[model samples]
Target: MHRAKLASFAFPDRPAGDAMSVIAPQAAVPRPVSRVLVVSGDAALTEQIVRGLNATAQRLDNPHGLVALAVAQVDQALARVGSDGELQVVLIDDGAADLAGSGPAADLAVQLAALRPELSLYRLLPADAGGSSGRRAFDGVAGEAIAGWFDRGEVDPVGWFRILAAEVAEKAATPFYDRLKAYVALAKDSWHTPGHAGGDAYLGSPWVADFHDFVGEELLRADLSVSVPMLDSLLHPGGVIAQAQQLAARAFGARRTYFVTNGSSTSNKVICQTLLAPGDTLLLDRNCHKSVHHAVILSGARPVYLDSSVQPHLGLFGPVPQVRLLQAIEAHPQARALILTSCTYDGLRYDLAPIVAAAHARGIKVVVDEAWYAHARFHPELRPTALECGADYVTQSTHKVLSAFSQAAMIHVNDPDFDAHLFRENFNMHASTSPQYALIASLDVARRQAVMEGWRLLDRSLRFAAELREQIDATGAFRVLTLDELLADEVRGDGIRLDPTKLTIDIGASGWNADELARVLLERHNIQIEKATHRTLTLLVTMGTTRSKVSRLMDAMQRLAREARSRAPASRPVPRRLPELPHFNRLACLPRDAFYEAGERLPLLDDSGQPNAALIDRVCCDQIVPYPPGIPVLVPGQVIDVAALTYLVRLLRTQQATDLHGLADVDGERQLRVLRREEAAPGLAPAV
Candidate 1:
């Protein structure tokens, strides 16, 4: 039996003086009960176990009470457990052998474990069964799924209760966050580098008092600095921060995990800097985030771009075909690393196991940018995560899908040859010495939350998305993009999967472009979507998504559909044709060289407002990226072609709502940065 005393601490939100002023004895607050579900067809056995648990709870004077409910069928047990967030332990009666190895009960246990990995499952055996020497113990999946087994006649209820209490306490611990809260409760005066000195600068001034008040006193007070040695230094963690990171590593299934406060973008850059050197070859996914492109430039790696299948109709880019990816690995055997994004922005996931295996065979490291897939490892349905696929390094934006503040991310290392000292140096290069203590605490708390309830939260989000997809599809004016619709013909049978939580709705039938519909939804219905293309809107169903939000979104979509149907034929808007996405295949020089070289901005259009064909073959010196899907259309050192230039011209003319990053407005005309003509050496061979 394990018993750990719970820590007693004052709430950080309460003033220090108030904590000291409370001297009177107060009534004991009701402790939350630990819910246990007993699955058994025998009423007598069920009552016996429930009575024992209740009596044990009373006898021990448990700080947390106990409640047990019995369900006859495995289906009912599963349903109850799924819906009850407080339920922790499950006891199944297997005396009848109905739930013996590989039976329905065994399957139910596996599913319940997946839905709540922290849940404790035990099998109840008959008294004589344990004494039978010929009886074989549970084996295989059933044996592994169950936490323990108990013979009813010899059951130790008090021991079981203590074990449950210890497990709960372990999962509830957030080392860094708890310490931060306790330190804040001390009400220590700060004379640190932060000039605000715990918001005193703002609170004392009338000019900024409103701003400070709006931001709240608790947040301001908790905004601490490195001067407080107890909080531990992020760069050289040896205390609570180190413990928090180790806990996160165990939760996320990483060999080692490092918390990153500068978002996954910086995480990618740090990894790149640590792994790659100038002139090293890299195999990269073309559909990756712009941050990857920036990493290439900063690391000075020679990139061999892998083509992603394009869906011209929906303006979407699918994952690289498995065949193409494998062939690229073979072709670029000299490549130092292979980096790709799993669960692309629209939620297209690649079967990375084979891909990672192939990359490893060639002595090339695999780095997966799972920036939007922080919750993938927590659920069984979302298994085969990058780490599980043998990736050397994985970067995740915890804030995107989990309960963390923005810019909070993590870098997970599983490399066989990872050099901690070198990685730490690179991490410190990108990390700020004056890091936000609140953000770090948020990361610590986020890890604890995910470990405790990630499966339940994800299960709810998946169901919500499914319900919304069906409702939206029935609206006639809109239809959710199924896997078949999202995948291009070339990559149809590539073992690709769609994340059900990400819904991409095709709104072509609604008679409104995606931008117009998004604006209407935000303005009229107070609803905001994740991203929008010309004819589709993508919505993310995250842990934060609620039933009320799902219902409100459906209601808004139905109203829009009705309005579309009522509109006159002449009033219905015509759909606009978008240009095919351009490919960045022409590498005239090294990206590092071109980016560092002298460049001049030239008008994209002539006086007549037509594209200046003269600039077609010029070498681009900067990245020209489209905003919604932040993939760069033209990267540095690429020789601009007619197709690429025409696509840019079309976007400038028709897609005024789209933001082109590298284009500048000079004399009221859009211009691009290109290397000087003299600098474009003659007969320069393509780098790729």
Candidate 2:
């Protein structure tokens, strides 16, 4: 059993306050050191070594500066170094062995030589020198002793300098396209990205014949491998892939840009992992997409949730108030960053500048989930993007509103001081091992489309939204929630944010439930609104909508509302509070842990007191989640919350609900797998 311990010292000890420190000049070392390559697994350690090298340069009275590139993974570092170079001091982090269990230090040394021929490499003993908080189980060496290895000619200085110089030279001269091409070849299209592989017509469904004809064959041909000639390599590259990424960086006003193939879900995780560690605290908006919450779990970081203002009448979450973020950071002074969603799903936009300024006041980084606001950068009227608001990391999902295919996204680092290397490392770790070439090509073209015609396209879209809103109001049967109603004094506190792009039609006063209205519309007219709830039916509009489509939607909504009002009013219990999303405090076991942990299957009522880890067994396979809002009623690692239970029971009672095939039937079946009571007795090992 892993027993949790109280916090004694969050950080390791440093040199005792330097109370009696003395400055001494060290002996001069050998010359001809033009470059230095510091190879380490830990980025923080690499930073310390760079600082140390600057000190070393000053002490040696050397005029030439050392250029360093620190990569977390050894494979990546080796790939970065060129064949023509000689290395001065190749410093490997002691923790690097855990990166992948290859072998002992001797084996590691040999592998290093194989990667770069005739290189002088030296391993630094992790002691107080690097200031690592974790246990250092390697050779016992002190800070002065580690520094001695560098200053006292313990390694071949001339060879080390040659290797580092060669690596640096290669990095400087390598073209981005070449790297991209290599990555394309290395990437084999699996069942992963680009659900369509090379646009092979044979594999496509007959129903997609028209789509295939509409989108040309050239588009598919260009969807070649990311490993193709001179493409930017995912692991390491210097070619067109690099050029494309660089172009994106320039277009987005970012220092660097990373193409994300796994959509905003992965993008969220990458941002969290790159900027924060286990001990760091993050301020999160309560209405954040489930992705941010998942990232927090993966990163092992605690979060201070800033509840966004919700519109009770509208039945939607709003953007977080700027003041709440300030209060949160002020309360948790040590918070490293704040994450917020720019424009919510309902199309309500939040001004991000004030929030950014507040977070930056205390040197805290701001990350914006601009997934829904992908068109914001293109449209001047939209809320300021993460770049415009001066956020450190901005994540955009191209597929949400843009023409790019699904699972397509990008992460931009806006700050100069932001760690590009760390971002790449974390991104590479969580991202797909084998990326789809189609997505890379799509992202390349998507950036061009967004930049060239985004503003013009969005302007048309805004006009269409306005026209639709007007028509919905014209229909006396249903009232469209307008700007006045949303901003009214009485509704201001109840309603937090409003996005004009969405057509949120209120069916509450029309004597019909939102669900009934939605069903009637779909059945009567061949038109469908998004999911409906008890109060409202939301309609989403993007670049895909035309004036004709809007007219038809208004016609259908008007007819449905009229038909609903003609019927007798049905009496039902009014829910006072909106459904609360589930929260998890601890993981009884990892996904793999729960897979292997022993437990028993029992009825749902009998298993209430027993600990349970949600798994993918047939009984638990069907995720009994609310449909309109797809928040999981019971997540994989959480003890089912009270809301979840009530929601499940209510969902079963509400036969009109479309989703929940499994849980709705759970009432009849007395079955659930949980920890056995006797096995979970005090002082005994828990069964789960």
Candidate 3:
């Protein structure tokens, strides 16, 4: 059994800049764990080796003191190695070693080394005098070699054991960063696409000069084109860009990971284009981003949407019920792929292990839209990641929850079963030929941060989340959803656990609802949340969230609960029941067909001054999507109904800024774009 606890293995206190210093002293608490794993038949010799390891490790300032796992055979060794995240080295006694596998000692050692790339391996041979039990049995030139491995003194040479090192280590190894630095040093002439190359072009221009200064000369200097050979090309990476991707793939536990500079929106489109085709069934969840619908429209895929389950009291869509997934799979078994959103905008995640297994059994490919879950894999407390849950394809917005710059995302592929050549072609189609070098670097370093510092940062983030939840709960006016609530009898087996970082506060039953609550927080308290729904408001906490900001928010909520609701406007209309999303049967044709067909624009309301729900045989040619939820109420070719109108009207009335998209008013006319009634035949091919 793995004895090391992540709780105890928390890196020791180091100087402010030494972020990669896992071995350092802290007088407050000296945790245990020195040596990683030791394999030997002799009890005394193993003890001596453990003692030697502890002496060196403790002196080097490791808080986790003297950790040594003595396994008699390789089976137990592999199990121990796999289970422990703190393993650093492995030593085998070749003489009396009863290895777990059926192989020679050297072969067994090689096999164990393959288990973890970071683990150092050594073999203990017979001594000259006392055959197996000498005091110097563990001492030799080989023993010196064993000590030499530890004595090299660096904790993790590859930088995998820690988060982003404050300073990128000075080595010949970092290809991408090295190339960029060298290119910037040259300060060469630029005949590039970006007009402000080297910031000289903006120097004399009146309006652009101030903006150029604001952006800084150094930044523009590094924003070089793909034509620069040393800097490497994103379109067809060979030198540095390819190496960076491989490093990230290994760090994130994926077979391969493609970096995207254009955010997960383009990443989603690439995945769709690669795995799906025109008329191919795509089992999609209705509660996905607007970008997903666009992908469907672009690919002309036949969509079979999963029934969205609602959190009745909260007005949020809960996880798709297990039965709903089963029914969809049974109905659309011919579907080429399935895409599910885990850790969605409001922080709901399905237990995907079982679902992925069930789909894979039927030869179905699974893709999880994990745009908000790049930091999930680093923490044990969080829900398991898409790759961990056996998805064939997964996309993550690295910038969302991790430390990457905005618009930077990662697409991880685990499918040895699909066409690699086709996937590469599709990736090139969506990804820009000349990507921003900074964005690519941000993703590279973000992956490093997630691997190295993720645990530390996430631990702090979760702790902060718990504090907010507690503070909010204490007020007794505002309420938050907990995993316990989702696990209760009426809601059990729905496969959900809240992302603690996404604090979804229920303000509906506070007698104030979301609009009034959001207004008071923004106008009076000067605190802004992410988005507010009819019944809820969401606040996103990432690695960068601080305790002080959280405290301010909590204090603001306390005041809002005690005074703001009662003191605020009174005539607020309580929202009616949230309308169920329009089903697939409501469509006149596939989304792509309506998307390209000739569309007519008409007033959203009738001449009698009401919603034009009574319009004679008009099909919606736009995805009527509100901003916060962004899930379309009706996609192209879908028949708009009274229920859809009811939801839209209530949504507009309660929302603070009232952001509605897709359908718009055209020049003094409140308009709805629809397939013209005259040509609205159900199966008519779109006029290309």
Give the distance in Å from residue 268's predicted Cα in candidate 1 to where it truly belongs: 1.1
Q: How are the candidates ranked when ordered by TM-score, highest leading?
A: 1, 3, 2
Model 1 scores worst on lDDT over the 10 consecutive residues at 6-15
For TM-score, candidate 1 versus 3, the one ahead is 1
Give all TM-scores, in the order shown: 0.85, 0.59, 0.76
> Which candidate tops lDDT?
1
TM-score of model 2 (CA atoms): 0.59
Q: Please provide, for model 2 over 43-82, each residue's C-alpha lDDT reduced to its tens digit, 9 standing for 90 to 100.
A: 5667766665655555554433454445666565555543
Q: Which pairs clash inside model 1? A: none
For model 3, the superposed segments whose C-alpha errors exceed 4 Å read: 1-174, 202-209, 484-491, 509-527, 565-584, 613-617, 649-658, 677-688
- What are the root-mean-square deviations of the candidates from the true structure over C-alphas? 7.3, 22.3, 9.7
Ranking by lDDT: 1, 3, 2
Q: Global lDDT for candidate 3?
A: 0.70
Task: Give the range of the ten consecutive residues with the poorest summed lDDT in model 2.
Answer: 679-688
Q: Write candidate 3's Cα lDDT for 1-688 as tens digits.
A: 1223223233433436755434444324423232457776666666666565555544554443434557777677767765664454576666554555455555555555444433455555544323435324445423333322221122232231111111112111345766787888987988976676777787878878777667766777888777688877777778788888887776666898888999999989989999888888888888777788899889988777665666555556656677778677776778888889887888778889988888887777998899988888776667467887899999999998898889999989998786878888998998888789889888877876665446566878887898888988888777876765523243376667778899888765566757777888899888888887767788888888876678778888888787645754565446454544444336677788888887888776667766666543568877888765567777887776667766676665556544678767777556777887676444633311
